[model samples]
Target: MKKVIVISAHPDDEVLGAGGTILKHSAQGDQVFWLITTNITEPDGFTVEMVSERQEEIKEVEKILGIQKTYLLNYPTMKLDSRIVNEMVPRISEIFKEVEPEIIYCLNRSDAHSDHRYTFDAVMSCTKSFRYSYLKQVLLYECISETEFAPALPEKVFLPNYYVDISNFIEKKLEAMNIYASELGEHPFPRSERNIKALATYRGAIAGVEYAEAFQLIKFIDKE
Candidate 1:
């Protein structure tokens, strides 16, 4: 069984980004782990601790995805700087030793969100420098909030090279996101049914798949 890890700066990212891949890999009996890099309990204008509320969202997601093992870095959300990742070098070095993942997925470095970019850099640095990190390739995936047009999708579009048909797992993704009832506060869009389905269909057409999940291929393994 291969060892796989998902690193997300935000909570719901694992599902929105590559939930199908995660499910497919796990169904193959691969050992899966999550490296959640933030504790984003508090938001600026929100009255409740969005961070703490996020834990429940995560729990509900775990039920659908069945990733029993997880790790949270507990660094404050968006507080990570280059210096902090440097400080985390040794800590990540230890995880590298422990997990020794053969394949890895993480946030895209060019994401619009600062936290996603920070986490992406941290994973890249860790993979490059860690003694045990001889990973063949590291793929990049898009989180919901981060992938919505703007800077994340230059030209107001995302062109993905790889797509996993998640039509089967799409319902689970929606179910997982539903657990975040607290954080879905005041969403301009209903968010329950339309956007995600539209994105999956849109990306599927581009990738020539039916009901797909999209990811930006930053690096790839040469199966040769």
Candidate 2:
């Protein structure tokens, strides 16, 4: 089984970004780990009950997604940009050293959320050069709302060149997403179940599959 890591700025970002792929990996017997950078429990205007609810939500998601392990850093939510890159990179690097993941998945750089952008930057910094030489491939997945709501600039557009067929795992992805009740909205909302399925169907159409997840490949080091 391959070692895999999915890094996200917050709890549900991974589910929205690449939940089907994570499920597919686990079903294939790969060891999947998650690194969530921020917790919603900060004093940035959230209540204790809300914090407790969000924590419980993630725990349920982990169980449903078959995540082998998780690394949760209690960084402030929605305030990742205020922190310096050096402060974030080392912690992620330490996780890399321990997990030694063969494949790394993270948020795309084009996301509108400041936390998402910062998380992508931090991941890039941590994996630069020979720091994590054992990494074989790196892929960036798009998060709904955050990625699609970005400005119409060409540089910020998410142009995915790779697709992973998730036809068999879309139901599991939707099931896992339902655990994050706080993050979901009505049908018309971007993070709604309808839109999530719609996006997957669109990607699958491009790949000639029933459902799929798309990604931008940042690097691939093949020793063969």
Candidate 3:
């Protein structure tokens, strides 16, 4: 089975971007790993108890997703920009070496959040051709609010050309998303259950499936 890694700027991003894909990989017995770069704590208005609760929720999400392992850096939230590329690249590269993932997933560079954008840049740097030799493919998935809410510029838009049919696992994706109690919202909001299904439905329509997740295939190196 293929080894896969989903890297995100925050905890819930993996769910919003690639939850169903993760489930599909796990169900097929492909090893799946999660790499979360930031953490929420007092600075984000989360008390100690809330932080602990959030951690527990992440574990539940991981368990439900059938993630073989998770690497949580717990970097300061929303401040990834302050960190230099050198600082982020090495740590991420280390994980790349350990996992030797054939498939790598991360946020698109055009995402609205600075953290997401910077994380994308760092990941691109870390997985350079000269660095991760085993890496054969890389894809970028869309985060709900952060991806959809980007500025109205052609360059900033998320244009996905790849799609994964998740008709069978949409419910599992929603169940995994719901684990993050603080992140969910009411209908009409980006992270709401209704909106999540709506987005999946919209993407499925593009791919002529009942439900699907869209992605940008950044690179697919076939050396033979």
TM-score of each: 0.83, 0.96, 0.95
Estimate the lDDT of model 2. 0.89
Q: Clash pairs of candidate 2? A: none
Q: Write the per-residue lDDT of candidate 1 for residues 1-224, one digit (tens) a residue.
A: 88888888778778778787788777888888888887764444434655556777777777677685788787887788888887666776677678887778888776677878778777877766245435666788866666564374454344567778776777777677667665453445634346767778887887777778777666665552
Candidate 1 vs candidate 2, lDDT winner: 2
The per-model lDDT (C-alpha) reads: 0.72, 0.89, 0.90
Order by lDDT, highest first: 3, 2, 1
lDDT of 3 by residue, 140-170 (tens): 9999999878886886677899999999999
Clashing pairs in 1: 40-51, 41-50, 41-51
Residue 57 C-alpha lDDT in model 3: 86
TM-score-better candidate, 2 vs 3 = 2
Tens digit of lDDT per residue, candidate 2, span 5-47?
A: 9999988899998999999999999999999988876478889
Candidates sorted on TM-score, descending: 2, 3, 1
Show the lowest summed lDDT stretch of 10 residues, model 1: 183-192
In candidate 1, how many Å is residue 141 off? 0.6
lDDT of 1 at 112: 71
Summed over model 1, clashes come to 3
